[model samples]
Target: MDLSDTQHRLLAYLREHIARHGYPPSQMEIARAFGFRQNRSARHHLEVLAQAGLIELATGRARGIRLTGPGTAGTPGDGLLQVPLLGRVAAGQPIGSDPEVRRELTLDPSLFRLRPDYLLEVEGDSMILDAILPGDLIGVHRTPQARHGQTVVARIEGELTVKRLDTGGAEGNGGHLRLLPRNPAYAPIEIDARIVDFAIEGLFAGLVRPG
Candidate 1:
């Protein structure tokens, strides 16, 4: 659906909220912000925004709205977020008791920070065409709110997947996240909430290839 002027205002408001708090505004919050008398009235706008492909339900909880768009990556900005690639968390093999931090990678800090806790690695040929060859380094945001079109490190059924994220907002609650691959040989992975702990390591904002 084409966004009306009011919807554009609402979407801009929502984007500000996300930039301020790293999350979307709630129905009540949006209504309060926009001065909507009824909750459903606010809901109507949010639903419209979702239909327009602006946000999605990143979390199962209500108001799990997340911005779906291109992140501030490779924007000629110098602000880089550096995280350690601790070590490889095997996707095709068993994970040991713990892994080691082998190297450090620089990325957009606005996306996420790499602490002693979280780590990620590229696996499989799904995103090969995207230059995410198996064993390549992928920067992770360690966030659950990965917007659509952003590349994410997803855990599905206890297995890890790196693909372009496609969200369906609240309507896709029945299970609506598709892990799209850059390579057409592999089919996109649809995530159902029934299996693993689905989490976004971070938006695949950047990558580093060794010479």
Candidate 2:
């Protein structure tokens, strides 16, 4: 299905907006961007695009727009991956878990050394020395097991954290497993499997720093 000029511009705006902010623009924002008098106009155009298979829309969510076309941000056949942007994870300390899918991101597989199943927003500066800073989206390769000295997304008592894994036991330490922070100010998070419910969520593949 061929798109009208106005539809093409609107689709471009949606792509640029998602590329810049990691999410789609709201209906009001779209209406304003395209000089529409009402958000209904924006919705109408979006529905047209959806019918063309260029995008997908979810009901009742402010940022529910998703690009799924070939050679676009989402979908395959153009060397891209539609990686889901899961909720935030702590880089300093384990924070409350929120694994909800905020949105899907169109990313190049070459960006990460290892392809990631999903992306997690970093929330703290604990991993600064390793170049994983706050607000950076870290790629996570989903795995139940990670090797020693690998950076991992770990879960402790239901909370999530990003840190380097240390399985070698330290003398007199409570347990052989611990999560190490790159910054010197923070101490190692020693994991005692006997007491704390611990699990390796995934290995850190790479990262994307938002501009």
Candidate 3:
């Protein structure tokens, strides 16, 4: 879908801020920066994009928007809300893998406000810079968009991993995804549908630390 120039630019800026800051830019910031005659102008653009199936809103926060791009996925399980806790992810060079994971955990839906379709354990360091450790378990919200830069569990290039989203722009063509890490030692990884299917498993809403 083609975005209006305004939408395109606004989305790009938000994406950039998310990459650098870890959240969406506030409507007030958008208003002051864009100098719209009214804050509603900036808000209208977001509403347009959300209606276009490119984003979502969180209801009460200033920057409560989420982009429904490729950061969502799911699997069924048992619970009051039927939240699924995935065993682990096989995000390596291998393609089309049926991971040997055998157990799906059940979690309380109220904790997340989202009854996730599945849960996966974080397994690498590409995202260590983001304060996510190797054994920290991540909860995915089963959504397509990661709200620009919200941390997400994504399937990239035949592997499932977690990272922040940095996508968009005039160059926002097909299969162009940028996976950024919080730690400077690590570099960002980008892939597309052809090389790697961008499936957003869900937001890493929370984690468990066994003391």
Q: What is the C-alpha lDDT profile of model 1 across 1-211, one tens digit per residue?
A: 7888878898788766655433345788888878889878977877787777776543344455655544433224443333566554332322332346654443334543332134555555667676777666556556667666887666554556667877756233346667787887777766765454566645565544432
Q: Report every candidate's CA lDDT.
A: 0.58, 0.85, 0.59
Alpha-carbon shift of residue 16 in model 3 (angstroms): 41
**Candidate 3's residue-wise lDDT over 1-211, tens digit each?**
6788888888777655644433457788888777888889989988888887766766676667655544211122322232344566433221242345444333334345454566565565666555566665555677766666777777764567667777644133355767677667666776674455567656777654322
* Winner by TM-score: 2
Candidate 2 regions off by >4 Å? Answer: 74-87, 99-121, 136-139, 169-175, 192-196, 205-211
Report the C-alpha displacement of residue 1, candidate 1, in angstroms: 66
lDDT of 2 by residue, 48-138 (tens): 9999998888887777777777546633554456689899999998998888998776565656778899999999999999999999999
What stretches of model 3 exceed 4 Å from their correct place? 1-83, 90-101, 104-106, 110-113, 170-175, 192-196
Give candidates' CA RMSD values in order. Answer: 18.3, 4.2, 18.1
* Cα distance off (Å), candidate 3, residue 162: 0.7
